[model samples]
Target: MGKVWCVGISPTDPRLVGIEGVTFHSTVNGCDTLLVATNKNGLGGISALEDNVLIMHESLATATAKGLHRMVVLGDTSSLEGRRWKVHAESWDSTMGVSVNSIHGMGQLIVEVLARSAALKGMQVILIRVGLATERNINRHLARAFTHSSVRLESFKDSKIPDLDAWTAMCLDESGEFNSEISSEQWAPSRED
Candidate 1:
């Protein structure tokens, strides 16, 4: 509902050639208006004195979380073009297919969801701290299943996610109760698990 100035990726990028108010820049800048799509790196360009709201996009998984394993999380990290994670025997024999590869970019999915919601509410700056705070608890529980308590979570951004989904899989057990048991299945192939 506001006069939103859409910026181009670059002047030569061709997205802003004839657009009335569009401008191009390497980084997000020149706005007293609310900020959106700024990531960790772009945070540097923000002015504290401005009344802008920052809608950032961060990955739920990054290269650090990449590797082979018995079962790889079907996400951006393990799916990078150069990466390859063969299915573990248990998962493969149980499920279908031979291997898993990445195609759809999943890295920034977390913030994208948040950003989309913010955009829906009208180009306002959306503040998201849930993924930021929930990371430790998630890493502590899931990673600890394979590695020690010191496997400090890297840039993986799903920290804001609630604990219910993974720990409390809705899949009913044989007796039709909520599955509340820890899985022995390794989620990712890691160096030390």
Candidate 2:
């Protein structure tokens, strides 16, 4: 049977020494699968596994540093929107807190992540962002990056609010239909929107 390894890194403590021993144990056990989760700022450490799942908490650059040569990344869809927005949302609890600098930084980080992932041979990469209400032109940016990098990019809509804000708004619109329909059912025939 193949083994699996899981590592978690907190932004407050990104030192590998905090996770290395456990990660090493999993590797020595012949673990064929590895899962890593980190906070928004935690870069953690260089990953030794060739095939694994990378979950970036704060920075995509950190995840890219793993240099897996081939692997998949699982994260909230909004991860590409820029860390400023995330920081604002966390500190202020409002989406309006994102700054232009943070958005630009996030964009660059995303591009780097995609480019690095593409460089790996026979590597499959998947990026997931949460609460993607509006692609807000992100698609065009991503399209260009993927085209130049020759990497496969796939996006899904998630509407779980702050937890999955990376999802496109179209997805949320579709979900809203359910609520609209319910409201309509409770209203008079003449009260349609």
Candidate 2 stretches greater than 4 Å from native: 9-29, 42-70, 82-120, 132-193
Write the residue-wise lDDT of candidate 2 on 14-47 in tens digits: 2222221123222213433233432244332333
Residue-by-residue lDDT tens digits, candidate 1, 40-121: 2332222421212222322111111321111101111211122222233221111221122322223234433444443333
Whole-model lDDT per candidate: 0.25, 0.29
Give RMSD to native, each candidate. Answer: 19.5, 15.4
- Give the lowest summed-lDDT range of ten residues in model 1: 67-76
Winner by TM-score: 2
